[model samples]
Target: MKRKLLFGERMLLGDGTEPFNAVIPFRLHGIFKEEEIRYALGRLQEKHPWLKALIQYDEQHIPWFQVPEATVSIPIRLVNRENEDDWQEESKQEWHSTFDYQTKPLIRFVWIKGEVVSDMLFVFHHCLCDGGSAMALLYEFLKVLDNPNAEIGLENPILGIEDVVPAHILQSGKKQFKAKTIGRLAALAIKCIPVGRKVIDRQTDYLIHWKFDKKTSEQLISYCKSRGITVNTFLGATVLEAFRKVRGAAAFNKVSCPVDIRRFAPQIKDDHIFAFGLMIVMSLNQKLNFMDNLRLMQTEVERKTAKLNPYITMMVMESAHDALKNFTRLLKRGKSSNDCMFSNLGRIQIPDQYRTFSLETVFSPSVIGPLGNTTTMVTSTFRGQMDFSFMGSEGYLPQAEALAIRDEIIGRIRQQLDYKTAS
Candidate 1:
């Protein structure tokens, strides 16, 4: 079975030189037998058809998820762990590693073997799935890894926009005319605009990861609840503040927040392997007080998120597919208008205790695309602790500045909680 790549997915595929990969690294507190690991992956591939497929380009040079008659298991690479941070180093390497999508599956694994603790990195081409889909796969992988006989049901993926947008909407001549007009206007504008010159020279990318203690994590959650704001909104406000403070007032206050499309489109199942993303740009009003700014930001987040129309956005993107190459060029050359991309995976629902192995910690997933501006901060709470993984290139955000921003964000959150406790 094969399906043409979605407009969003094709954008990630780029010129095929740079890989857009997402890696989820988690620590396990038990030894994993090599054969058993392979068996578990084989079972997972059997369940999800996309996991066993490779990317193939048709004569028209369009990419497709092509499933061959011969079964191909997701490959696993083993690295002898020297210390606790071996996985971190391996993750950096994986970020730079390009996938041979023609011959191998879009997903692969890396196992860092330690004496008592092992860290496994689940790496996938970002075009194949988003962080949400990756998390679902991780959950099932653990379940099957712990028990080979475990039954993790099959997934019915959204093959195309037809599956997501209702037939009535697609058939409406008014909607079709609107989409066509918008697409044509966009293409004309793109053609008329000059390609931006690449000014920033990106250096070797780095990832900084840390986890807040359970107490601090709980306090942060309580603080957000007390403010009547979602954790994501609160964190988004803090991130904006941190950049403004550390990178100076001139830094862009815009923070791109990705909303899972599954929330708006029920047809895309939770376990489906898909990569269409909906993003909302959140900005803070510098005139307001810190707390006041947070409240305003929270309100804006709620309002904008509620208004997001996944169907229209998907349709618009599909219409602009003809100008995708130009869009890619613009992205690669243009200066980043946003400070950073912030993603909060919320509290991870994966169990800590499995039958065979116990999950020690789940580091926030990180992905560095070849697109301009590699600064991204990803957060997720697992086992009652909030874990963060910050990725950036020196050219876009220096390592020292990134670390400072991380500390500033954490400090801002803690300071608010501390003040509340004292008052």
Candidate 2:
């Protein structure tokens, strides 16, 4: 049967960091048959267009890929020369880290290359797939290998959402209200806009990650239930609190949250889930104060959650080309991209069904930066625990400073969770 791609599929972000490459680490119990894995990817790529696309530039200074159906060998490079015991673990950073935008990553089959081969890491940029797409690919890959004739195909790529809906029209990517709604919201943005500030003093370097265990997770879950707030609402609160601690109130007026378009268009699948998702902006300043933060954030989050039947984000830029024009191109040359995007891809599924390996923790670090600052975060859940890893540039955010601020903020959440029993 003929397949297709959706609006999000064709839209990928590449001004700096490619937003679709996803990295996954898989453990092999037995020796990996190189040819079998190669064949598996070949068959998978034939069904997914993203793997075939390459990051290249045209004469116009604009970036676009000549997406074609091609199967490149998923090479596993083994470097035999190394002396690690002599230096600090920081010296071994290269093996564990990668520079943003460098999409083509080297896959290392640990067991084959050294004393251990069980932990194999596969890294890719988000230009290839979002969490949904990555999960789809994994499930399909495993299914295809298990059943060669399994019906595995993606919908043909089709454009659905505009890259950038004019802020003047939508005023934050939401379906702007009519004269009546506008009259109401205008009062709201005006009254609420004062406390909000544009983030200034961008830092350039940082290494920060936020992790939540099941106990904390359950506390948050219960807290949300008591307050009629979803975990997403709690996340919105956590994010605003984090930013307020660092960027201050400025994080409020300019926050962008992602809403999936698939709910609005079910016909689209993996290739189509690009940046076509919906966006809803909220006043982050309204989310200050622990109690008020929960109450206000819950309402705001609910407004967006009500639309999940539909999709924001640093991830927003993927489809931002929708608003791309000669005028915008000129204006954005020296401006920030979509303020600060807060993407909470809530709980994820890296199941333990495979006998070969058990699912451990899932770490998602968003590749976000523009206008000298990077403010993006992704959260994942594993074994009843959740961890959030944030990615940003050293140019706008010094790693140490970001972590310092992150720890202070994380401490607040811990305190809140600790008080849950008392409250």
The true-versus-predicted C-alpha distance at residue 368 of model 1, in Å, is 0.2
Candidate 2 TM-score versus the reference: 0.66
In terms of lDDT, which candidate is strongest? Answer: 1
lDDT string, candidate 2, 195-257, tens digits: 213334443433355567788877777877877777766776666566666765434444577
Full-model lDDT, candidate 1:
0.89
Task: TM-score for candidate 1, please give it.
Answer: 0.98
**In model 1, which residue pairs have backbone atoms overlapping below 3 Å?**
none
lDDT of 1 by residue, 1-423 (tens): 889898889999876789889999999999779999899888888888889888898899989998889987888899988998998899999988999999999999999998889999999999999998998988998999999899998777567789999888878889888888888898788777776666457887999998899999999999888889888988888899899999995599999999999999988888988899999988989799888887888888889999998887778888888899887887777768899999999988999998778999999999999877889999999989999999999988999999999899878888898899999
Q: What's the distance in Å from true for residue 239, model 2?
A: 2.2
What is the C-alpha local distance difference test score of each model? 0.89, 0.49
Taking all chains together, each candidate's TM-score versus the true structure is 0.98, 0.66
